[model samples]
Target: MSKKVILITGASSGMGKETAKALIQEGHTVYTVARRIDHMQDLKNMGGYPIQMDVTNENDIQNVVDTIIKHESKIDVLWNNAGYGLYGAVEDIPVDEARKQFEVNLFGLATITQKVVPYMRQAKSGTIINTSSMGGKMYTPMGAWYHASKHAVEGFSDCLRLELQEFNIKVVVLEPGVIATEFGEVMLKNISQFSSKGAYSSLTNQLVTATKKMYDKGQGSKPTVISKTVSKIVNETKPKTRYRVGLWAKPMVWMRIYLGDKLFDKIIMSQLS
Candidate 1:
C-alpha cells in the first residue's frame, strides 16, 4: 500500500505471479523470481522485475538477494512461495525424492528467508510470508512427504515468529487449500510415476479419481483468492500469524482441529480411495 519493495518466489505462475501483479497495481515495487524466467515476461510487462532464480541453488539465492538489495536497499516483504507438490506413499517414494521434496518445499524456503532476514532485521520492519498449505495443518493419505514438509514450515514459521518479534519482523504462514493451480496435475503425475504400479496402486487410483472429479467440476478457487490474501497480509498493520485461504481451507482445518485426528482421517479416507 505504501509502495514498499516486495520480493516473491515461484512468481512464474499461480498465486505468486498473481500476487506480483496485484501488488504492482497497488504501486508496490515487486521483484518476481523463479526458475522459469520466460514465464515471467508478462510480469515484467506489468512493471514488475522478473529475476531468474532456482531456490535450491545457494548461489542463485545469494545473488538474487544481493541484486535486490543493491537496487532497493531493503526488502519490505519476502514471499517464499516457490514449491511443488510431491505426492506418493512414503514407502513407495524413494529416499532421494523425499530429500528433494524437502529441499524445494522446506529447505529452499528457509534459505531464501535466511538471506532476506538480515536485510529485514536491519530495517527492523518487514514481513516474511511463507507459502505453506492446508496440508501443513492437516494430512492426506498418500501425501506423506508433502505433508511432512509443510508441517515443518508451520513449525519453522512459529519459531521464526517468536525469535523475530523483538526486531519487529513478522513471519506469517500462508495455508492455501485446493486452489486452481497445476499443483494437482503435478501431484497426480508424481503419484503415477512413483507409486501407480506399486503396492499402493488402488489407493493412489482412488485419490486420483477424487482429485480429478474436483478439478473437472471446476471446484478449485481462482488464484485471485490467494492473491487477495497476499494483499491483505501486506496491507494489514497486524496480520495474523497464519492465514488460510482458498476452498476447503477453513472446513478441513476445522475438522482436524475439532474432530481429532482419528475422526478426521476416517472422514478424509472416505472421501478418497
Candidate 2:
C-alpha cells in the first residue's frame, strides 16, 4: 500500500479515532480533526496530528484543508466523518434541532468534501470516504431526524461518486451498523431531552427501553472492525463505492432492500419485545 496523506474528522472518539491509528500504523500521514482538542491529544500521541475543528463551521472546514495542504502539499484521502445522531420523533423534535442535525451531519460534511475536491481534482486522484450509517438505508421509530440525515448522505454520496469518477476521484460511503461507541449514549440523551414526555412518549419510552439494553449489553462490534475496512479501502486499487461494515450492517441493509417495507417495520418494532 502506498503511503497517503489522509484527513479524518470526528477523530476525538470512536471509529474516527481508531481509523486514524490504523492508517498511521500502515505508514500513512494522518491529520485528525475535531472540536475537542484535549480529547484528540491521545490521537496526536500516536503520530497523528490533531486539529481543533468544528465541522459545522465553514471557516473551520476550509482551514482544515488549508492546514493539511500547507504541510503535506496534497490530501489523498478525506475521511469526512464528523457527525452525530439526533434521535426523536419527527413531530417531537424542534425544527431548530432537526436543522442543526443536518448542519453538522450533512452540510458540514459536504462543505469539507467540496473544499478538498479542488485539490484532489488538480492531482487527478483522490478518495472521499463518508461515514454514513446503516440507518441511511433503513429506519426505526423515534429516530426520524437521525435517519433522515443519514438517508440524505447516502444519496449525496451516490451523486458525488458519479460526478468525481471522471476525475479519478473515488467516493466511498461507509454504512456502519452498531459499533461500540459513545454514539448510542449521545443519541439516547437527545431522545430523552426532546421526546421523553410528549405526544410520542410511549413510542420514545419503548425505544429507550429497547436501545438502552442493547447498548448496555455491549453487543456492538469494536471500532477496530471499521478500521480494518478503512485500511482496505485506502489500499485497494479498485475499491468499491460502498463498504457496509461492523455488526449487523450487511444483514440489516439487505433485509430492508429485499423484504417489503411493512415486514421491515414489524422487525424494527419487534425490538421493543
The candidate that wins on lDDT is 1
Estimate, for each residue in 18-121, the C-alpha lDDT of model 2 and write its tens digit. 88988988889999999998998887788889999999988888888899999999999999898899988888788999999999999999999889999999
lDDT of 1 by residue, 1-273 (tens): 477999999999888988899999999999999999999999999899999999999999999999999998999999999999898888888999999999999999999999899989999999999999999999998899999999999999999999999999999999999999889899999999987886899998999999999999999999999999999999988999999989999999999999987899899999984
Residue pairs with colliding backbones in model 2 are none
Please give each candidate's TM-score.
0.98, 0.98
Model 2: residues with Cα > 4 Å off, grouped in runs? none
Residue 116 in candidate 2, Cα distance off native in Å: 0.2
Each model's Cα RMSD: 0.8, 0.9
